[model samples]
Target: MDGTLLTPPKRSARARGAVLGALMLGAFTFNTAENLPIGLLDVVAGRLGVSVPATGLLVTGYGLTVAVASLPLTHAVRSVPRRHVLTGVFAALAVSSLAAALLSSYGPLLAARLVTALAQALFWAVMGPVAVGLFPPGVRGRVIGALSVAGSLALVAGVPGGTWLGRHGGWPLPVTVAAVLGLVSLVTVAVLLPTTRPEAEPAALGISPDRRRFALVLTAGALSATGAFAGFTYLVPFLGDVGGFRPETIGVLLVAFGLACLAGVSLAGALLDRSPHGVLTGAVAVQATGLLGLYAWGARPAAAVLFLVLTGGALGPVFMATQHAMLHCAPGRTDLAFAANSGAYNVGIAAGAALGGLILPYAGVRAAFLAGGLLAVAACAVLLPGRPRPAES
Candidate 1:
């Protein structure tokens, strides 16, 4: 009945699964690239001859670029074939990582990171839709769930692995490994991903239908992230100064925390689609409690590690809940909502690091946890009234 249907056999399930695996690897590679620096901040700063706080500006700047560029870059690439766009992003990231490895000075390294941030922004914006489109509707949820697992595993593997490599091999080793992963991801995508033309008009920036809900969701996201990252970005310092962890021991602890994060993601995925608001509120409450515990007992090694695990566990779920909330609240504007959410997330990252940097010298590391807990409480307050609306009668 249709020439197109008969033109060629569809890809086999095995082939499709391999493509999906490649996409997941892309997710893993990109996340690893972004998070690699987190574990190597001190090493990077020391090697580049900059103060640690000034080194923090690298994280701050990268997040700011992603927040600023996500929407626009996504719009620019909306009409491009998904395969080419994804492949290009991976290639760019590979090059950026290589530049970061080779650059001698802090300025050039920072510049290279900024370029990577641009590619990362577009990658996050488009990755979901492309992944979902590759599968039938009936299997989409599974595909996304698997992709999320890949992302969580990136944390499981990337951060600690990078830290270990950096400790033994030097700062460049971790980033260089990230570069290799990026290249592998690039080739996988190019060879495996089928070209898919845009199915609808590109998502654009516009006023959300429910302004109050949108504002609340955005604020909640920003506040929660600020709370988490304030302490998280400085976690290595906290572990050394407060928890009394040796450099090698810190890597093991980070891996433990990453495992908790994976569990949190799994739990959130199970719960969020049912009640986004409840899950978000509960996550914030738990996180706040954990941060407060860390603040009070961080001087004790066991207590600090316990609280760290709890805090890490809650982080993933909060992100999942925020994404779920944004999608549910915005009726026809999922794209705009996602973009706003992404921006809020990164803005919170910058804000948290800046806030922690300011406070670390003045008040102390414990105070950072206290401040972060208060921010989480603030997020809870904003989200209290933001239960998803009842279905239309």
Candidate 2:
């Protein structure tokens, strides 16, 4: 038997559910920590005696750390049991969150966030393979989608809730809550999850062995994400400038978008395993259509929100499907492949924002949406031509 296949312990339904719950909780905790600064930016800046623009670096710095460190850190812990590595990462995140809350000073807080960023980068890199190992292959798409739901929930509830709490209770309150949740997740994982080892199997039954094909998947993902972010990053301004939405209305719209994202992932969970390529193709088309709609009809308030919903719904599933595709295509090196995916995602985000900024100066915000639409169309072109053959074991 190859080292790639490990038989997971046959556990009861309740036990399996507990394990999945713990993993999801861990996902929620880390995602909340990553986005907490977005909520506390003004408060943190005021308390730390810095400009709000300077505090924005907190988000950028964390993204850079995750993008740079994901592959190397995952490689470093390649030989460790996934259970142990995850537990350690959660513990570190908890500690870092607590430190950031207590220190409150800008420099110390930034340092603490960077610490958590390292853990987050590594966590995302390995979580896909870990989820696959714990569940049956037939339900892989569902498991991955469920896990991705945690992230969507974080965006929908965590950030807004944290901001509200910070506004009422104080900035430190949110970080402290995140730290406590991280600890709870750490305890849950340590107690509930079984120790699992990596399989030495060549690859999964339907995966492709061609490295170039794997690279294509990554490229497509990057393009799709770039297209999404180009308009998404400037959505608030677009709504205000074009649609004439008030501040409160825009906040409601953001929540609506998040809910659409949740719905999107739920649907993808059911369909992805049966037809990975088809799902990707459909998602890309939907995203392109939504963006183009926004470009053409954004001046109308109702149409703008409608297209926003469409875009969010399609955009939400792309992450999970892409991750599933990567893990499926390279089951033998799931961690490494996912690390690359994580990096690609971050790069796409940065690139899309940069491109949008350039377009914003020369063209109006609507033109940026058109640019994003073109990129999404290009992404679809890349994936529609070839079917990735299932690799031989």
| lDDT scores in order | 0.75, 0.82
Local accuracy of candidate 2 as per-residue lDDT tens digits, 1-393? 332244446777777677678778878888888878887888989989999989988988898888889989988988787778888988998999889889858888899999999999998987777766666666778888899898888888888899899889888899889889888878877887667554432222225445766777788889988999899989999999988999999999999999998899889888988887788788889999999999999999889989999999998788788888875565347788888889888888878888898899889899889999999999988887656775221
Worst 10 residues of 1 by lDDT: 1-10
- Alpha carbon deviation, residue 393, candidate 1 (Å): 15
Native-referenced Cα lDDT, model 1? 0.75
Model 2 TM-score, all chains together:
0.94
lDDT score, candidate 1, position 311: 93
TM-score of 1: 0.82
Residue 290 error, candidate 2, Å: 1.1
Residue range 1-393, candidate 1, lDDT tens digits: 111111212666776677678777877777777777766788888899998878877776787899999888866766787788888998998999999988879999999999998988887776665565555533333455576677888889767678899989988888888788788878878887777554332222221245677788789889999998898878889889988889999978888888988887777666654555677889888888888888899889889888988898888777666655544454344444666677788889888988998999999988998999999999989988766565200
Cα TM-score per model: 0.82, 0.94
